[model samples]
Every structure is written in structure tokens, then in C-alpha cells.
Target: MLTDVQLRRLTPREKPYKLSDTGGLFIFVQSSGSRLWRMKYRFGGKEKLLSFGTYPEVTLAAAREARDQARVELRAGRDPSLTRRQRQAEAKRVDKQLQHVGEEWMKAQSARWTPRHAEDVRTSLERLAWPDLGHIDLDEITAPMVLETIKKIEARRAKETARRVRQRLSAIFLFGMAHGLGRHDPASVIKGALAPLIKGRQPALIDLEELKHLFHQVELIPAGGIEEPLIVSSFD
Candidate 1:
């Protein structure tokens, strides 16, 4: 058994050495004068070392308890090192939410985009995509769910808005996948399914009578408050 006094009294030599305790737990004293707690064990016909912690910060009793817990895990046919890693990974998984990850992706890409474009990206996602997806986890989203979300925008006669939203969704999913936050890009496969962007549809005033009526209405407007320039906008 390693005592607190013995641990404190341990001095570094020219080379690193180990002071073994019960159940394969030991203190590794390095030449740089750092004492690290470690355990030696075998799992699946291979030897592996597990670290408890450094001396003083992790006391002798704490080290023994950790070693005992690791032994229990090992007896259950589990690898203690891998179990620790999994717990660590779970604790670090704070960006599982789609909106959170999307915002993060936008911020990361913002420097490459114009300020107006970045704001537009943020607005489009928040307005058209987030109500359906913001609360959901990245991995939980499906292609059908994405389609449904954009379909609402298309139903509003906003096909152009829907196209932009879909493009942004694909970019967000791609960003999530590239960063290991999601399994796949659900939006990438459905680009062709959206309502097409319509341009230059036939004017509502298709005949001479309707054109004259529209001109009459325009004449009734009070002159020159930016309305004339707006009304006379080039077709191009």
C-alpha cells in the first residue's frame, strides 16, 4: 500500500520509475518530477495502462477507489479506458441540437461571407427552418421532415424563399456532417423536388382594357415620392 507520506517523500531520479501498489495501481515518478498515478492491466490478451491522476490532487484513497472501479468494469468484460472515453465524449456532446450546430456552422463560415449574406443566412434558417428543426437533434432529422418544412414556405407562394432555405439547409447539414455532428445531409437529395423559381410570369394586365385600368390607377397616385422610379423599374 502506498501511503500519503511515502507519496510526498518520493523524489525524481535520473530516470522514470514506478512504485507499485495493490491491484496493479502504481505511481509513476518521472525525471521531470511529476508523479502520475497509473494502473497496469490486461484486456482481450493485450496489456493496457490506465491513468488515475497525479499525486496530491488525486489522493491515494481516491486512486485506489478508481482502480477498484476499473477492476469491476474489467471483470464485467468491459474496457475501463474505453468506458472513460465514452463518458467523456457524451459529456462533450453539447452541440447535438440542429439549431445550435447550425448557428455554430454559420459563425464559422461567416468570415468568408459578406455581412449581409451572413445575416440573410441566419434569418432564413431562423424563419423558415428553425421552427421545425431547432429543437431536434442533428442525428434525428430526416429527409421527409426537411421536405415538409420547406413545403410550408413553398405553399406561401414563396418559391424563391423556399429554394434559398433549402440551399442553406443543405449547407448546414453538410457543415454538421463534416464536423461529425450529424450522420448525413438529408437536404442534399431533395433539391429537385422543390417548386422551381418562377421569373417573368405574364402580367396580370394582359389586354388593352386592363392595361388602361392599371394606367388610370397609377395616375391617381400623388406624384413623385419614389413611386415613379419604382413603378418604372426596368424589366431586366
Candidate 2:
């Protein structure tokens, strides 16, 4: 067993050397003076080495615990090195997704949406959402940030535009979530926060004088005339 004092006193040499401890665990002293922890084992008749960490950082007890866990895995016929590599790859893939941007999300939708629509979505994010929320990690975006971001559009009296932007942003976040990037769609939290749209009255000739004038104009036109029907339907 290697004590703390002995491990600390072990300095660098011209070549790397391994100080073995029980159960295939050892301290590797490198020529550069770095003390690293390593475990050696055989799996499927082939020897393999698994690095734990450095001295002081990994410590003697931590190295033993890691080695003990590796032993359990070995007993179960599992390769700890392969499992660790798979986990590292998965973490890297997740990090790449999390670091992705709104533009990437927009681009992914290009196959399903028209170019103009995709361009509009990108433009909305760049103009309204990006300044405040785009550069941030997808999981870090909260409902309040989404609400505040849309309020900028609402401030310009673009109620309908604000609604469209919110819908687009929500779709983007949902897409990100499906791809394992985002945690939730913050824009969905403010469903009814924007101003309601005002409906306009239908076109009609309500004035009595306007109705008489329309009849007079129809009479002025020749029978079976296209202009008369067009003018009449324009008021209808």
C-alpha cells in the first residue's frame, strides 16, 4: 500500500515508473513529475489499462474505490474502458446539441418549410430573440426571458407579428427539444400574454345614397357588362 507521504515524496525520474499497490492498482510517476493513477486488468484474455486520474486529485482511497468498481464490472464480463468511452462520446454529443444555435434549428426545418418561411423564422430570431436569448444555452432559456423577448415586438404595436414570432420561437424550441438540445419551450409559458387581435367589419354598402348610386351606375353600363358586376361586388 502506498501512503500519502510516500506518494508525495516520489519525484519524477528519467523514465516513467509504476508503483504497484494491491489488486492491480498503481501510481504512475511520469518523467514530467505528474503522478497518475492506473488500473491493470485482463478481460477476455487481453490485458487492459484504465486511467483514473492524477495524484492528490484522485487520492489513494478514490483510486481504490474506482478499482473496486472496475473489478465488479470485470466480474460481470463488462469492459469498463469501453463503457467509459461510450459515456464520454455521449456527453460530447449532448454538449454539441446544447451548444447549438437558433440558426441551426431553423436550418433543420428547411426541408419541411418553404425557403421564404424559413428565412422569415431566421429573421425573427435574429431581430427579436437573438439579441436577448439566442446566444444562451437552450436549457438555460426560461419563461421570463421568452416573455420579455416578445414584449419587445409588442412594444412596437405589432400584436399580430408578436404572435407569429412567439409561435415560431416555440416551434424552434420544440424542435430543439426533440433533438435533445432544449429542456423546454419557454415561449409556450406566455400563451396569452400578448394583446388580442382586433377583427375588422365585413365589407358592405350600408348608406342609402350609396345603394342608389350603385343602381344608377349599373344602369349606365350596357347590359351583360362585366364592369357593372365587378363594381357591384366591390361594395357587397
Candidate 3:
């Protein structure tokens, strides 16, 4: 067991040192003059060391709390070290999958989109959606996660961009499902979640007399070569 007195009386050394406590826990002093806590345990017939973070920073109580949490995990027949590693591996896999999906989605839409529009779509997805939900398996993505991503865009008052992002994500999920990379398309379930934009009625016009008057006024205006025609056609 480690006592408060022993922990408090501990001094820094030029070289790293270890102070063992009861059970498998140990306090490690690094050459950088910082103290860290760790636990050595046997899991699956192999030894594993789990880091509990730095001392003074983690504190005695916090260290004990972390140790207890690890013990609970062990009791459940789970290896904390393996769990951490698996999570990291899964995150990497998801990142790769998203990159592939994004590329495929861009290619599929390229023919129908203008050059600038295609570039903008790619940029928006890469900058916004890719960072948050990109590391999640397509099948595992929830409605709330999609909503949260849209909320981020909405926060910037980007209504049109948000709508396009949702559409792009839906397409990605559909593509993933087609290739067996995903199960459900949460984006499909939440369609019409955003507010609709209303298109106002067209301007009302008078009879032929008013039209002729407008045309006469237009003819009376002095023209400066093609510039005047270009300006006049812009309003039409």
C-alpha cells in the first residue's frame, strides 16, 4: 500500500525511479522530473502495464479512483490495455473508410456538378463533416451525430451549405450500404428536418399600355455600346 507520507516525502532524481505499492500499482518518476502512476497486471496470460497519468497532476485520490476503475474493468474480464488499443485501431479504420467514401461520392457527383460547385461540395464535406463523424463507422452513425454536424453548420448561419451537407451525407450512407460498408442510412430518416425556403410570387405587371411605356423609356435611354445592352439584359 502507498501512504500519503511516502508519496509526499518522495523526491525527484536525475534518473527515473519506480515506487511499488500493494497490488500491481507503481509510481514512476521520469527523467524529465515528472512523476506518473501505472499498474502492472497479467491479462490473457501476458503482462500489461496501464498508465494512470502523471503524479501531482493526477493526485493520490484521483490515482486511486483510476485504479479502482481499472479493477472494475478487470473484474468484468476486460483487458483495459487491449480495449484502448482496439479503440485506436477502430478509429483509424473509420478514418480510412471515410476518406474512401468521400472520394467515391465526389466522383459520382462530378458529372452533374459544375466545376466550382463540385469543388465547393468537396471542400465543405472535408472541412466540416470529415472532422467530426468521419472516424465513425458509416453503419454506426446515429441521427443525433448527423444532427449535431448540421447544427455546427447552422451555427454559422449556413442554411444552404447545411442542406447540401445533409444531402451529401445521405448519398455517402447510401453508397456505403450498397457496398456492404454500412447498414442504416440515418440521413434518410431525418429528411425535411431543416426549415424550407419559401419562393415568393413573381412581380405583377400591368396591361399593354404600361408595357409599351416601359419599352419606350428603355429606347429613349442612351446606349454606350455593348455595355448598355449587357446591363439591360442583366435585369431581364
For all candidates in order, the CA lDDT equals 0.79, 0.74, 0.72
Better of 2 and 3 by TM-score: 2
| Model 1, position 169: C-alpha lDDT score | 80
TM-score of each predicted structure versus truth? 0.53, 0.46, 0.44
C-alpha positional error of residue 43 in candidate 3 after TM-score superposition, expressed in Å? 20
Q: Per-residue CA lDDT of candidate 2, range 106-206, in tens? A: 66767976564455556656767767876577778788888888887776656555777788778778878877776798888897777776666434555
Which of the two, 1 or 3, has more TM-score? 1
Evaluate model 1: give its TM-score.
Answer: 0.53
lDDT of 1 by residue, 42-147 (tens): 9999999999889989999999999999999999999999999999887556577788888888889878865655665677788778999887877889899999
Clashing pairs in 2: none
In model 3, where do residues sit more than 4 Å from their true spots?
1-96, 198-236
TM-score of 2: 0.46
Candidate 1: residue pairs that collide: none
